[model samples]
Target: MVPDDVVTYPTHWEADVVLRDGGTAHLRPILASDAEALQAFHVGQSERSTYFRFFAPLERLPDRDLAHFTQVDHQDRVALIAVAGEEGHEKIIAVGRYDRSGPGEAEVAFNVADDHHGRGLGSVLLEHLAAAARERGIRRFNAEVLPNNAAMIGVFREAGYVVRQHLDDGILAVSFDLDPTERSLAVMADREQ
Candidate 1:
């Protein structure tokens, strides 16, 4: 049995998204039951993708790490998973999440499946994650990306938020204010079309 005080997040967070390549995916909040799927997704990533995400050579997600990533309160810490394929055959193609760092600010991260690269899934996931962050009163999203991850950098650069970057120790720190600029709004509008 479960405790009554444990709040389950609402289903409104779920969405159906169409990828840039005309493929479809279901985007929803990460659930505790998704631990195995998340692990499989991690294992499916390429070595470079894994390093860019975890900042180290991780052969597998340990039990503790899997639990931490799968369980979330959905307010201070939130994760959205993008799944592709049919019901039982579903696969986690990408994940985007944010951890509240301070009032009005949160640290963001994302990982896309190796096979799903260049399909605009990252941008789609980022947009949804930003919306969720704003709803939770977060005004800024921050991220640290390796200098060689041009794809990730481009996603942030093309987003409508005012993005600032600083490089130190081969890592690029990027920040985006939640206030959407005209360019950002236009880009989002185009995505909806």
Candidate 2:
């Protein structure tokens, strides 16, 4: 187990972070220290999810990608993880990021462990991440999901994102805009599931 003291909440320049779920999951700034864990997680993803995320075959996280994930400034980029830590279970199960595209706009992306999907972690992470982004001056948050990724699509749709299937950056994409009050998400979450 990560001694309770060893699992410290990460710091962020972009927002006030919090550790929730008994620190089994946390909303914190991704750091250079996270490179190895992030790389390993991506490397371990299932082939299908790897293809969905990269839009191609990738066996491991390329150095450039690792560098970008670990070193970007908070204004230009930031990431979060749902970390699990116990004697035999120390790992990052879910991850997401937001990269600034312009004033008031950010391109966001998220992924969860195959075993953890459909358990509300993605929605919870989005709720926290979107709120954090809003606090950091981002009014519009966008995401790109492959046409075949129905689980992610369901999450976005359930979150009340106005999604339009369109060709973006040469691939099918689904974009999301976060409402500050989350009325849309709450209402959508209320409907038949």
Candidate 3:
């Protein structure tokens, strides 16, 4: 689906406080005005989460880097933020994004705050992204995760995705398929809409 000419705005904005096991947090779409929050989220991530997300240790990003990330066309890309709740407060806890690389294929990516790991928010974010991608006719989802990120690998496995490990240049990466059940869920979600 093509992005609407009208600027994309956050809809049904409410804090999705996930109280299951993990600490509660807010889940919402990233707005164009959230560049500072996004940058802060990236900067404050643990070294491991940063490496997992960027495939390397980035000391700190300049303004240009944040701009490129925040100013994408909504037609083909989406960014979601998970901020800390009443307990954690103002800290960005998790982040996820989906980018339509081509017809039937979307690239899915996510990261959670270091202290908030193992709480299952990464999987929740991924599920939301996969459903969003499916709604946009994306059936094949791909991710580039490092070899040591067991939590992320677990997320993919829980989603019933198939994984094929390979090395691209020197960085370890895994490609996966988001199965039909995920698609069905996306469809059902659309019906509810």
Candidate 4:
């Protein structure tokens, strides 16, 4: 059993989101049992998608990495996944996570299946992950993307956050506060419509 003071699974963060194409997906906290599905999801992504995420052409995630990704503590390290289909047929279509890197700050990352790209899933993951991080006392989120990953940068910009970026060694480092501003909320609301 989990210690009484330790943060447990946050079922409250689970959500059913509608994509830009009117498709539906379920977003929920990651689980230890999700290793296989997560690996399968990675296997299905395009080489471009894999490179954008891992910064390398990995044929597959090693068992250790799989274990690390699937096992997360609800407090400092957290992950969320967007899944499609039902029960045994479920497929992990996307993933988002935040790892606390400093006081009141966290490093965020995401991966969306190539087939689901441009459906606004990245924005949805960012929104939910930010909300979850805030609940855990994170005040800011940061990410590092390859210079050519304009789509990822676009997702961050379209969220209406006052995103700050710095390019170094062909990588773009982006960051923004987690606090929701009027414009951020407005952008979120507009997308939800």
User: What does candidate 1's lDDT look like per residue over 1-193, in tens digits?
Assistant: 2324337774677889888888889988888888999999998889999999999999899999999898889899999999988878888999999999999999999999988998888899889988898899999999999999999999898877788999978899999898778988898999888
Q: RMSD for each model, in Å, please? A: 2.5, 5.6, 5.2, 2.7
Flag regions of model 3 displaced more than 4 Å: 1-6, 10-19, 86-89, 182-193
Per-residue lDDT tens digits for candidate 4, residues 34-91, read: 8999999999999999999999998799999998888899789999999999877999
Q: Which residues of candidate 2, in runs, are more than 4 Å off?
A: 1-24, 87-89, 167-170, 185-193
Per-residue lDDT over 1-193 for candidate 3, one digit per residue giving the tens place of the 0 to 100 score: 2124325544543346553474567776766566777777778787878888888898676788777666655447877778774632566678888788788887778878787887867866876676666666777777777777788878777655656667787655666666656644664354334
Taken over the whole model, the C-alpha lDDT of each candidate is: 0.89, 0.68, 0.69, 0.91
Error of 1 at 143 (Å): 0.4
Question: Candidate 3 at residue 100, lDDT?
Answer: 84
Residue pairs in clash, model 4? none
The residue pairs found clashing in candidate 3 are: none
Clashes of each: 1, 1, 0, 0
Best by lDDT: 4
Please report, as a residue range, the 10-residue window in candidate 4 with the lowest summed lDDT: 1-10
Better of 1 and 2 by lDDT: 1
